[model samples]
Target: MKGLVCKVCGYVALDGNKEICPICYAKNVFEEREDAYKMPDFKAPSGETEKKHIPDFTVVEKCGLIPGTGCVDVHVKIGEVLHPALSEHHIQEITFYIDNKFISNVMLTSSINPAAVIHLKGGTKGKVQVIETCNLHGKWFNEIEIK
Candidate 1:
């Protein structure tokens, strides 16, 4: 589903129809929500530049983790296109949330690639949300269900 995202607060509209931001209450400050799952080419065939700061959380290991076994490693990276970690424009941070609870946050700069493999405890079976913020662009989020 696509909707307008608030530029100030990174709040995604409940539906694409909303013209006002629910969180920041800002008007006329919404941009179309880009689907991070489907990555656009770094340079489109039409000669347009595509942004690739969208975050995608992928379960590297099997999601149905056995309790008391070990930690589950989740690989966080750009969906398909690699994001340029340049000094002028780059991703600032990546935050992890499990079942709506904060888990970990990784601070990044332009020198390093905006990718990380984070390990989470294997006991809880729920949703894993990954939110990444770009210095130029706002925040982008994606999730995966872990069993």
Candidate 2:
């Protein structure tokens, strides 16, 4: 089976029955990632190193609570420190998933910022996952519980 990774802490699971990440202690944040091995092997960082390599996604703006109307704007920063977006090494794509289903994807370029602003329809209300792949670092994932 593919390995699992913690979207919050960048913790990787090399074993089976991966339910929760030991480092971050996040349950629903773990997702089965097939390309996780290509990512650099590392442990969760402490307070000062939080922005070292982990992607930090923040909801810059969101839709109203009325449910199903306008669009939801989500901004994803590649990492707390912001990953490099160069021609040699850069993020390839940022994908958005709603309720484990594909919603939209943005193909990134080295010229633009590694961060992405994705617009999702205002109907989904379950789990929102943002997955990105780096040319040199492989794949990373972040999830948000929408209720």
Candidate 3:
């Protein structure tokens, strides 16, 4: 993943361009990152390290909390093996994107589980991407198609 990252707050701009850092509100502090995120290699089997860093998704077509709202529930977990949540090393945040466009983000602490659920608009269909940043592992992302 080639993108622009905020030098101050590590906010990634997947489009490879950003004038200001969205997280830190810093201008002219964005730098190009050749490996902004880590994606699972489909051709190779994932090891324990990959399982601990890669994000997982579970999509529900209907919103259980708000029925009749026509919202799609997207559940995101940090990893299949469940990464450790310690004061030193933990999942810092999880970001949502639809077709490479920004949607929402969830900031986390070590006290809680590294997971989040975002509700999308009705009839939203595209490549739903989830990116999670670990304090030790940097960043990892996974995508799923919804129709």
Best by lDDT: 3
Question: Which is the winner by TM-score between candidate 1 and candidate 3?
Answer: 3
Better-scoring candidate (lDDT), 2 or 3: 3
- What TM-score, over all chains together, does every model reach? 0.60, 0.61, 0.92
Give per-residue lDDT, candidate 2, residue 82.
Answer: 77
Candidate 3: residue 27 Cα off by (Å): 2.5
RMSD of 1: 6.9
Query: Number of the top candidate by TM-score?
Result: 3
Error of 1 at 140 (Å): 0.4
Candidate 3 local lDDT, 1-147, one digit each (tens): 777788998888775557776667898888887998888998999999889889888988866576777888988887889989999999999988888777787899999999999888788899988889998889998999989
Clashing pairs in 3: none
lDDT of each: 0.66, 0.64, 0.86
Which has the higher lDDT value, candidate number 1 or candidate number 3?
A: 3
**Tens digits of per-residue lDDT for model 1 on 1-147?**
355666786655433535676455788887876552233343654122233655656675644455566678889985347777899988777767777555677878988888877777656688877777777765666778888
lDDT of 2 by residue, 58-123 (tens): 663345644556566677877777788789988777767666555666778899888777666665
What does the lDDT read for residue 30 in candidate 3? 85
